[model samples]
Target: MKIIYRNNDRYAIKKLLLDIGEPELERECWRRKLHKPRRINLFFLETNEGITSLKYKYPQKGVETIIDVSQYDLPECGWIRYKIPY
Candidate 1:
């Protein structure tokens, strides 16, 4: 999911947890360093060939950012890039 934050191009990569749901809240996170939380509603892209064995744990600290989908520990076959603000 390409997010447009401050009109900058940044990317994040993570494994897809579940199939994209209907128009709903996208992944979100909070940063204590900045003192505020960030939320975004990303569109649902198709679920293509993904890493079956490779798994990813969700962020607990609440750090939301654009995802690059290719940086997962498993070299699965999913790709996503999101635009975000720091």
Candidate 2:
């Protein structure tokens, strides 16, 4: 899948996972890192078929990450709405 993060640039999900680990691991890391004023927010964009997008919104910017699900399999955890606490 294609992820649009930070400056709305597109990135491959496989590459991102390679850099950051799995989704669960990434969420755990993010939860630990978000002990300050700044934070990142995650959201699952829902659609009739299933989750069509995954968004990560940063403090200063809008969505820092966006995963397009149309062409990829959903994560093993399944599609659930998430907003990682800061």
TM-score, every prediction: 0.18, 0.30
Mind sharing the TM-score for model 2? 0.30
Q: Model 2, 1-85: lDDT tens per residue?
A: 3332222223343433344446754565466553222322243333333445545555565543344444454344333333434
TM-score, cand. 1 vs. native: 0.18
Q: Scored by CA lDDT, what does every candidate get?
A: 0.28, 0.40
Q: Quick one: best TM-score, which candidate?
A: 2
For lDDT, the strongest prediction is 2
Off by over 4 Å in 2: 1-16, 19-51, 76-78, 81-86
